[model samples]
Target: MKQIIEKKRTLGLLLVILGASFWGIGGTVAQRLFQQDNIAVEWLVSSRLLLAGILLIALYKITHRQASIFVIWRTKQTAFRQILFSLLGMLAVQYTYMMSIAIGNSAVATLLQYLAPLFIMAYYLLTRHSALTRQDGIAVTLTLVGTFLLLTNGSFSTLSVPFMAVFWGILSGLSLAFYSIYAVPLLQQFHSLLVVGWSMLIGGTVMSFFHQPWLIDLSTWTFSTVLYYLFIIIFGTMLAFWFYIASLRYLSPKEASLLGSLEPLTAVITSVWWLKISFGGYQFMGTLLILLMILYLTVFQKKQRER
Candidate 1:
């Protein structure tokens, strides 16, 4: 029994790490597509969500042959909620994040998205009448200082990151917060795959109407471009999500979240090395502060649970 549990935990750790790494690398891949191929963000977002959604639903069907994929839409209330989640949560998050990457480097975009937790913290404080904990305050201060340094390179006179990129990046963070918070009730009612799958499909379908990705010219795409596109949809979006969710079967949510810090770290490394994005001393310090904020919150959460 002990060995079995240990093996499961190990598997969980591997899955979560793989999942987060895939996501991190995926952002860099998407940036390459935008920079080299001039691929439209709308088309990529629609294509990725549509295909990934179909694949996930299919996987769920294969694994749980007895379960119904349509169960999430059985009631009107649920159907509405699912549609809203698909549009406002999944689609919004994806579109905004991709826009951020298109406008800036993946490293900055991803780090900005990590601000989702802080937004959630603020939301609860405002809406739920929750008291501010010391740890929360510290984490907020660290993130704010980190963000300022990242954007300004520790100088008040100039902005290191583009203003438009920062605009989209902050929006991406807010959208991510919404995505995480709004999905809770639906997640409680259905399997994560089911909820996520439907949301993706719905969001993709809606985006397809607007972008018409099928109409895009494929003749201009090189072989490598085609391969990169496939990698984004299959390995990055689909497998990343699958691995992360599967990890939850063996690890606690807090543990999984703590492991998720790897996503930004991987993004930063790949962006700096592969994309040749600059990472100056101030930016490095900013990154460390942000990461430290994440670590601090994780410890705080663990202590809160213990208490």
Candidate 2:
């Protein structure tokens, strides 16, 4: 039993790490397409969500042949909730993250999205009127200081990242907070595959009405561009979400979330090392501070739970 559990845990760790890395690298690749191939964010996002959603649903069908995929829509309440989540949570997160990458490099865009926890904390404080714990205070402080340094690059007189990128990045974090919080009940009740697949499909369908991703021009697409596009839909969107959700079977949410820091770290490394994007000293410190905030919160929460 112990050996089996250990093996499962190891598998979970690998799955999550791979998922996070794929997501991070996907951002960088999307950045390449956006800058080099001039792929519009609207078309890429809509197509990714639509195609990945179909593939994920197909995967769920193949794996759970006896299960019903339409169970989420059995109840009117659940149906409404799922549709709400599809638009507000899934679509919002996808669009904002891509916009941030379109306007800025993936490193900065990903780091900004890591601020989701801070927004989640703030949401609880506002909604529940919960008193801010000392640890929460410290985490918030670290996030604020880190964000300031990251944007300003230690110089208040100038912003290292563009104003619009920061705006979209901040929105991505906010949407991520909502996405994480709102999906909890549905995820607990249904298979992650079902929930995610439907959300993506619904969201993509809605976005298609406006963006018309099918109308996108493919006349200029080269072999590399097609490969990048496929990578984003398959490895990045589909497998990344699948692996992360599957990891939850063996690892606790806290453990998985801690491992998720690798996403931003991967983005930073790929952006700098592979993409040759500049990383200044102040930006590094800011990144460290943001990561420290996450570690501090996780450690503090664990200790509190133990006590």
Candidate 3:
């Protein structure tokens, strides 16, 4: 029984890590696409949510064999909150992240955006009535140090960061933090897929007015672009999200946050391989520090469970 449970935990961790890795690929693809067309950042963000939302809704209907578009009128209050969370947490974080990339470097944007874990820990401590452990504090400290290293371009010099970029990065982190905490209760109440799918649908619908998808030049779409877009929708949005929820079924919120720390590491590795980008010694050290912190938290949690 003990071995089986350990195996399940291992499997869940692996799924979350894999999902983060897939999510990591978005930066590289987005960079390539945006460089080619220089499309409005809002449009890019809105289009992704709108299209991905539609795809997810279709997928949910097919997989669940349920009626598409169940009337959610009675749950309007909760649904409204979900929509707000999705828009601010999902849509806003995504948009700000892209804006960070636009205004700063990809590596910097990624590292800064990952400050979500810190915000998540804080949220849990304050609102969830959870006790703050020493390990949690250490993990948060390490993550912050790693972020500082990345932001300073590995030189420990803060002079290079632009004012607006910093603002966007911080905002992105806050949004992600809020999402991580709030989404947990909502997920407990509804299927993760349903919550995510519906939130995406609502948020996407709201964004459509700004993105103006009807103006998209469908005729100009190349096979490669279409392939990239489909990859984002299916692997990035749907499958990765499903894996995330599955992991949450087995792990605590803090454990999930620790696992999610893999996202930035995966992004770094993917960027190196796919984009041939390299990091400096300090950057590598920072990444290692963050990974070590997450490992410590996971190991500590396991020890507590055993005791």
Number of the top TM-score candidate: 3
Over 4 Å off, model 2: 1-19, 103-112, 129-131, 140-167, 242-261, 290-307
Ranking by lDDT: 2, 1, 3
TM-scores for candidates 1 onward, in order: 0.80, 0.80, 0.86
Candidate 1 lDDT by residue in tens digits, 1-307: 7678667877877887898789878877887888899899999999999999999999889999999999988999999998987888788878888877777756467667767757777787788746667765776677667765654467755535687887888888887677656666776688878877887788899999999879788889999999999999987888876676666667644345445556766666787898887777897887788678656654565567456
Q: What is the lDDT of residue 67 in candidate 1?
A: 92
Relative to the true structure, candidate 2 reaches a TM of: 0.80
Model 3 C-alpha RMSD vs. true structure (Å) is 2.8
Candidate 3 lDDT, tens digit per residue, 132-160? 87877787788777655643446645435
Name the lDDT value of residue 232 in candidate 3.
72
What 10-residue stretch in candidate 3 is worst by lDDT? Answer: 150-159
Off by over 4 Å in 3: 1-12, 66-73, 147-153, 157-159, 218-221
lDDT of 2 by residue, 225-257 (tens): 999999999988888866776676766543454
Supply the global lDDT for candidate 3.
Answer: 0.70
Compared with the true structure, all predictions reach lDDT values of: 0.76, 0.78, 0.70
Clashing pairs in 3: none
Whose TM-score is higher: candidate 2's or candidate 3's?
3
